[model samples]
Target: MANDFDTIKKNANSFIIEIHKFIRENFQVSIGDQKKYLDSVTKDSVKTGQAKLGSFIISVSDVLLDSMIIIVYTFLFLIYKEHFKLFLAKLIKKENHPALMDILSQIKVSINNYIVSLIIEMIVVAVLTSLGLWIIGIKYFILLGLITGILNLIPYIGITIAGIITVLASLTGSGEISVILGILIVNIIVQFIDNNLLVPLIINSKVEINAFVSIMGIIVGGAAAGISGMFLAIPLLAILKIIFDRIESLEPWGYLMGNHVPRKFAWRVRRTKTQE
Candidate 1:
């Protein structure tokens, strides 16, 4: 746990430092570009700069405000969680109340275990990534590794962003396209190992939620709640499945939420039936 925490802290520091470095480098480059653009433009330079600044401020504020609201809501929900459970119980029929409580308990347990497993997996990924990048003598390996590990939390989208950022950082640091390709190869190898070995042993065994369901949940979540929704979706679906599986009428929906067999296996079964 201490080691995990250290890795997170170290990675975070690296991430921030690399961001600062990138910004500094770009700012230096953009200075000449901006001068050329402003000189070429007919509009008043000061006014244009002010307008751009205003727009940037507004966009940043909107993001910050939304994030703060989410944090506050989450805090309040945690504080009143027990009361919320009681509130839920009161809404249901007395006969169904026990079953509801049972379902909720299962949901809580499943989510908790899944979260723990994810954290462990992330720690392992971060450590290995940092080590690998360090071995290859990448300048911002810590930052890239940290970003890669953290982004893996979001289904489908996160790793792609990680790859782009890491590759760009490599390009900036080394000025070599070969380094970028190397990073891609390392990323693919790490991702392959993670998906096949680490995920099955850690996340898949515990979550039992298939990739299709998880991806759909992530998309739906993003549509409904933006980034937070994507983070919340899988757990929400997992909880829904627990409830659906428990209720007599909802068994079919629970199965729908469950993992599907491999396509090859399904095809084989279908062929056997056709032969029969």
Candidate 2:
């Protein structure tokens, strides 16, 4: 019995050592690409100058203002859909991008797997938010659930704006602080699921963007076209990377955008016969 116990201990130690060694090797391999990503971001740091923290604060304020304005316009369009449709038709006609449209369509199909996954995730978010709202005794819980589910289509900003509007609407109707708090709590829970789980799964489907480039894209796009631009920037960058990968002229740009250079060989993981 003592001999058996000693052998077991020795095997466990070997197992642990092998696992650690494998992990260390993988870490060293990934570190090369990590350094390249860092270098790329550092090079772009100069261009991101002047637009700092204060700029983000200002951007937040502008986003809030724009969301509220959108709410107003939404109500207006509800009353006059035909007029809004005419205006939108004129706008799209004036700014046509057939090439861009074709590219985006192809890219969307390429990422269809990720898109379907996102829809499943939004369904989960809807269920949770709806349950929470119902528990909190919100009268329009179903309506709020639908809105929240739709807003989940937009990352980050849309969720917050939708939550705020729902809470404010609740306040206006019920005039109860507890109701507002309940709404806030439910929204927080939904956002927690979104940020921690759904986002990591969906966003990480592609190569991860560096943190600094993401912020810079938000800043630059927001400055150029407000809320729409901020929401569009990340996907636009990803799409650009996809296009660059296809076009030889743009291969360098694709390399610059990506976190990792494509490696031709798959590194094999081997286990000792004793482990097998």
Best-matching candidate per TM-score: 1
Name the regions of candidate 1 deviating beyond 4 angstroms.
1-70, 155-157, 164-173, 194-201, 260-276
lDDT per residue (tens digit) for residues 63-180 in model 2: 7676676567557856985675456456555444454456556666545554565577778788888889889887667777877987776556768767865764454345444666
Please report, in order, the local distance difference test score of every candidate based on alpha carbons: 0.74, 0.66
Distance from true location, Cα of 132 in model 2, Å: 1.7
lDDT of 2 at 205: 49
lDDT of 1: 0.74
Error of 1 at 70 (Å): 5.2
- Per-candidate clashes come to 0, 0
User: Model 1: which ten-residue window has the lowest total lDDT?
Assistant: 1-10
